[model samples]
Target: MYEQFTKPILDYSIALVMFLLLSPVILLVSILLAISHRGNPFFLQERPGKDGKIFQIIKFKTMRDLTDVNGKQLSDYERLTLMGKIVRKTSLDEIPQLLNVLKGEMSLVGPRPLLPEYWTLYSEEQRRRHDVKPGITGWAQINGRNALSWEEKFRYDLEYVDKISPRMDAKIVLVTLEKVVKRHGVNANNYMTMEAFKGNVA
Candidate 1:
């Protein structure tokens, strides 16, 4: 009942409130990233949402585009700017996603969205993570975030899907705030991001 009816109201109201409250921080980061990259500070890319629907996920652009003499893009660690590092560590990069919530493309709590290219890689069971709208944070995020292996993350995602409720979501949100405050599990094994999910995991 909560998932189908009440959650959407809560998500929209909370996101609107948060966006207004954080507008100053968002604007400040935008200007800083714009100067740092000398280009657009917003990043948008396609991610699978509810029932594997495609939607453009929005975020702050925290990496610079730099290439070697061969013109090949550098690694994520190499492309990460100082400001980017701070923003990512503090999770300010996620501030723009409030717009996604407003657009009804997401929930406040559910499975985190993943790259569209990974759709084919997921087993039928793993694909169940998309049974609900994606979230900016989720069960896996608060539990281990990028620190967890793909299998562990999927386990938590499934658990959430099978047992979603307002109480569970509220607790997840509270724990997520604490996790963000501590900057825990912001990266996988100290890397700038998690390693790409290959089909072998399934």
Candidate 2:
């Protein structure tokens, strides 16, 4: 009942309210990012969504397009600017994804959408994460986020898929808020971001 009708309605309503409430923060971040990125404030990338459909996910531009002498882009740790680091640390970079929720490409809770190229790398089981709309935060995110291994994260994702319910969603939402407030699990211990997931090796 909730997943079908009530969840979408709640998602849309909450997304609209949150977007309006956070408009000022969004604007300020956009302006700062525009200045830092030289006019581009939003980062858009094709991510696989429900049923493996591709959609352009939107986020705040938190990295500079700096390149090496050979023209290869710099590493995430290098390209991340001062303000970008702040925004990322505070999770303000995820604000734009509310728009994705409003647009029906995402949900308030679900498996986080990953890079499209990774579609081919997922095991048949891992690929099940895309069975529903991706979210700004998810069961994996609340559990350990970047700190969890790829296998562990996918286990949470699949668990969420199987046990989705209003009670479970509510718990995830509450825990996610606590995690965010504590600024926990935002990045891996030795990486600027979570390490990319490679296919599981035997």
TM-score of each: 0.97, 0.97
Against the true structure, candidate 1 reaches a TM-score of 0.97
lDDT of each: 0.93, 0.91
Clashes of each: 0, 0
Q: Which pairs of residues collide in candidate 2?
A: none
Please write out the lDDT profile of model 2 over residues 58-149, one tens digit for every residue.
99988988899999988999999888999988999999999999999999999999998898999898898888889889999998999999
Model 1 local distance difference test score: 0.93
The C-alpha RMSD of each candidate to the native structure, in angstroms, is 1.1, 1.0
Query: Which lDDT value does model 2 have at 77?
Result: 92
Worst 10-residue lDDT window for candidate 1 reads 193-202
Pairs that collide in candidate 1 are none
Q: Which 10 successive residues of model 2 have the least lDDT summed?
A: 190-199
